[model samples]
Target: MADAAFTQGAETADRGRLWVVLYLATTGLVLLLMMLAGLWMRLAQSGWLDTDPALFYQLMTVHGTGMVGIAALGGAAVLWHFLSAHIRLHAWVMGANFWLFLIGVVAILAADFPGRFGGAWTFLYPLPASSQGVWPVWAAALHLGGLLVIGVGFLIWCLELARGIIATYGGLGRGLGWHVLFGGSTKDVPPPTVVAATMVAIVTILALIAGATVLVMSLINLAFPSVELNPLLAKNLIYFFGHTFINATIYMGVIAVYELLPRITGRPWKTTKVFLAGWTLSTTMVLIIFPHHLLMDFAMPVWAMAIGQVFSYVNSFPVLVVTGLGALAILHRSGIRWDLVSTLLLISVFGWMAGVIPAVVDATVAVNSVMHNTLWVPGHFHFYLLLGLLPMIFAFMIHLVRVEDVTPRGGDLAAILYLLFGLTFVTMFLVGGWASVPRRWAEHLPEWQIWDQIAVITAAGVITLTTVFVAMFLARTPAMLAKG
Candidate 1:
């Protein structure tokens, strides 16, 4: 019986590793491909290529949807692998999640490329139905249907995680370490577990909202063309889902930091009441924070917009104050040797913090009134997702492989080039937005073309260096694992 149990454990370990590789590889390839699409659009806007406007919008739709999906998948992989060490996450569930994501991605790609669906990633109501012959009604339906499938998959994954936590840690409140926050003992709960608890709780509610608002509505519209869903309600639902989904990506991606930083820093990241309190605050705030995305909707309630700005301010405080300060204090004068993984992890926190400034500014109704339609929207997200979450994902990928003392040659050069060029690329977007340049345009005025040109050049360098780094990392994985 003991031997059988040991064999079962070994099989689970092997399957977990395989799932990690599958998720990582799929996400990395998709990200690079979408980055290429983004580059093409930017170059076309710079007047270097006379691409058709319809084609540009189609690419935009794919790139936008693909990037968000990939980010969530990559972050889920990181969180799942690490969380498994502390809890009982079934390998088959994760495998199913990956397959579901892949199916949804393929469906979306078909709709965008072959079916020629181009209502932008948001797929706002009326627009999907009113594509003006650019795509068939069925194509738009397929696109939203694909997203619904993915949403169902995500709901399943989150439910499993929640179940695992509940079974292992007694209940949701205990898993979240809320007992300690409410004046109980904090001795047993793990910090990473608290983060996982926070994520699952928040995402579960938001996912339901997404299904009801965006995916279900879209499906209903397709089946009953005269269903007459409220446009304002649909818009609210779309942004709510879109905003929560991407924000969840960053939160999920940052789990790597909470789990791995202690290993690298030779410190214990305790699940103190304060820590739990911060995440608890985040848990409450993230749900209501979608209002910030709707600040520009005049039809939206003033109370909702006010709530958006207030939550935006309060939301930044908990995450930044708790995690940010804790991370810095852990790293400060620790005499720790900084390697690629450690450096990337550290930089990710700073990138996220820096990115929030722009985001908070944009969340304000006054500033959003002026900048919401500009490139600033993309600039803020690109900063956090690109420099912040993506680096954390890369770091976690590196963590998976048990490398020896020897570092790969050119690792530093690759990291430097990727970081430097990537920053310049996102910065140019912010600069252009400051200059009042609009987003999602295939053709830029001569004045705005310069920003597009510079962004393209920097993006090319970033992508090139990233490709080389990924190749090197993959090549070394087998040897590194063999050493174990």
Candidate 2:
């Protein structure tokens, strides 16, 4: 009976592994397509591509929504793949979320393309309903409905993870090592993966709830023009949901660094009290920091904005400092061999840390007054997502397909190229932000076109390298799956 139970668990792990590979493949394909859309926008801004203004916004809508959605899905894959080792998770939950996610993607694409709904990804309250004649009511409803579908899928995913963690660890607090941190009990302290997963599950569940509330109310408002929501309330909910959801992706993706880095360096990433405290601090602060996104709105409560500003400074440090120092300490005397995975993982640490500087800068009320509407916003997020989160996801993919004595051809070159051009690309956005170039504009002035043009060229390089990475993953996926 014990042997049979072991066999069953192995089979379950194999099935989960297969689904994770599929999730990564989907994520790679979508990421490549989104990069193309972003490149096209840059080209249009540089006057190299003749895109219709409507199409540009449409592409912007799809690109933003698609990238965020795929990031969450990919992050879930990373979280589940590693967390499963510590706790039993249902493979069917992963499969169910995948199908639901695909369904949501289809609905969103149809709404953006044929339906012509382009109010931007935020879909901000009345904007979806107030598109004039650019799009019909059905388009707006479909778009909102699609988002609702996606949120539902992710909600289930987070819940399943939470359920697993709670069942295994006795409670979410214990999963986060709170007992070890506070109660001073050393027994059964959860690893970094569980602590991270616990944090993600708590925050993501809250984010999705906030997201669903606003989405449903907006859909109702759309269906009945008289049923209205306060614009400020809507903005708060939207940004809260949006900011938390996106930030949670980084937390989820960082698990790869935590789990894989020590393995590569022949070091153990133990969950000390410091690590637990760092995550605990971040888990609270990340939920409260979204108000920084609304700093420009005078209608928001002064206390909320203050919380946003203060916590923005505080939130940027805790987990990052702990993780950064942890990585360095582990690698210091480990004599680890530098490969594509290790290189990218280390770079992700730097990118995540560096990205926070600009984000915190913008989160300041005074600086946000000037830079909030500029390209600085995108620069800050793209810095982390492109350079930080993508590398983590990419490293995990390569790790999955990696074999002993078989080096991936040109893998290191592709990673280097990605980093170089990604830096240049995001730097162009920062430069443009310093020049006060407004973001989400379909066109740019002559002086602004230079930065856009440079960004266009750099974006092409980033996209090309990303394609190479994705192709490498795709080629090896079959073998990886078969081995599973």
TM-scores for the candidates: 0.96, 0.99
Tell me the lDDT of candidate 2.
Answer: 0.92
After TM-score superposition, the amount by which residue 195's alpha carbon in candidate 1 deviates from its true location, in angstroms, is 2.5
Which model scores highest in TM-score? Answer: 2
Q: Give the alpha carbon lDDT tens digit for every residue of 1-484 in model 2.
A: 9999998999889899989999999999999999999999999999999999999999999999999999998898899999999999989999989988989899999999999999999999889999979988999899889999999989999999999998999999999898999999989999999999999999999999999999999999998989889999999999999999999999999999999998898889989899999999999999999999999898888999999999999996999999999999999989887778888898899889999899999999999999988999899999999999999999998888887635555657677778999999999999999988999999999889999999999999998888877887899888876775
lDDT of 1 by residue, 248-354 (tens): 88788888888778888898776666777888787778778888988878888889988999989998678677788889878888887767778778878888888
Q: Quick one: best lDDT, which candidate?
A: 2
Show the lowest summed lDDT stretch of 10 residues, model 2: 404-413
- In candidate 1, how many Å is residue 1 off? 3.4
Q: Clashing pairs in model 2?
A: none
lDDT of 2 at 338: 73
